[model samples]
Target: MRKSFCTTAILLAFGFVSSCGVAWSADAPLENSDCVKCHAKVVHENQADGGKHKTEVGCLDCHVGGHPPSTPKEDIIPQCSMCHSGEAHFELNNCLGCHQNPHQPLHIVFGDDNVAACNTCHPAQVNEIKDNPSAHGEFDCSLCHHDKHGYIPDCMECHEPHRPGQTYSDCITCHRVHQPTNVTYGQDIPNKDCGACHGDLMDTLAAGTTKHATLQCVYCHKDTHGYLPACQDCHGDPHPQLMMKKFMKCTDCHKDPHDLVK
Candidate 1:
């Protein structure tokens, strides 16, 4: 009886082994084969919109192990830092919060907290906003660039122009949107651009008969906004030293540089 029981057990174990081996051999190539066959959607999207991810890397580079049913999910879905390490942004634990799809990494949609991630790449723009805080600085980076990366919002979408006939190009001429109050412009800026904001001051300067009337606003204001140049900067003590000593201030006699009479 014992010998008969041992023979039956041996046969059952051998049959099970043979069946498993046949199944593995039949399906092995398909199972552990090209990823695109099963994950076609992921592959397609990655190819179309993956940005640097598609161009720089491949499926096996990230997967790193056996495919699907043979491989555990944790092994298949890699941590971003596995490849993107050594950077400050890579140190962030939850990459998926902003970069929702690893397959298409640059298809980013960020919330308020995630906006700071922009500083990782756009440090200059972030610093410009920090150095000169304004209404633009109060909002997240995504607030303006809501569509995707590299999108520049129309200023008119949120702000009315200072006056009629002003354009998007005109707004940027005097205002750096990141640092809106730090209004600086090139010499090419038209007097009309300045007149849009300082109409009264422009009128006062234009109405005068002095040499100041012949000069453009920028000729005196020079390179920066709200910059006050000393009379000595150009004229170099228009009065005698004795008269300068008594009068002390050029504005005391000239009244206003914009509308100078004498």
Candidate 2:
């Protein structure tokens, strides 16, 4: 009975109800309304862009132990690992570095230098840039994706197009931002894009009377940059075997594949 009296006295000292043989006021859990009264802005921010936190959790879920007056400020605060464990991203230190606000976890932001931080969740893109070294690979991820997380800057922001009036879409069609130097494009790429670098070859191909003039540069060159296909790969032994033996190379007679002689 003395122990019960002591407990009741302690509860009363902390401004809790003093009724004996009844439910102790300390046992009564704090409602969402109780938290909202003090932390309306935090609650509102969480509801606005909380992602899963607004739907899956509540006030008491994270901020446990007790509120101030009964518990210290740090005692009530929760760590990210309390709920977000078991993943490589979760294991990473300094959740606040990128997340910034616990209320809106998904609203990620990056500082001027966050390449190492970016590599945690985006290892594929980071690895791709590292493996394939280009001018784009040398800097931090935030240099390109500045202002906000997931923001993809236009290639034209840092680089001039190969031709005038070329859009960001056109730049990505040939040059992947991560590995920009290794130029590759599809069949739909026009001859004008090739003309940007090889104007002489493009002019020669355009002026040629052969069927090759009707084809796109990619149609002959195919997948990647600097690929030179032999005439035999397309037009195999147009002449007799005796003539082919005498002239093993097609270019020896044709002179130029771009402007073939009739």
- Top lDDT prediction, candidate number: 2
Candidate 1 accuracy as lDDT: 0.75
The per-model lDDT (C-alpha) reads: 0.75, 0.79
Report the C-alpha lDDT of model 2 over 1-262, residue by residue, as the tens digit. 4336536665665434333223224566566656554466898999899987778988778888866546777988899888889877777778888788888988887777777777778899999999998998888888899948879899878778889988988888888889989999888788998899999999999899988888898988899988888777888768889888987677787778889876
Q: Where is the poorest 10-residue window by lDDT in model 2?
A: 15-24
lDDT of 1 by residue, 195-262 (tens): 88899998998899998887888887887998878888998766678877887578888898887849
Best by TM-score, which number? 2
User: Which residues of candidate 2, in runs, are more than 4 Å off?
Assistant: 1-29, 244-248
Where does the lowest 10-residue lDDT sum fall in candidate 1? 15-24
Tell me how far the alpha carbon of residue 57 in candidate 1 is from the true structure, in angstroms, after superposition: 4.1
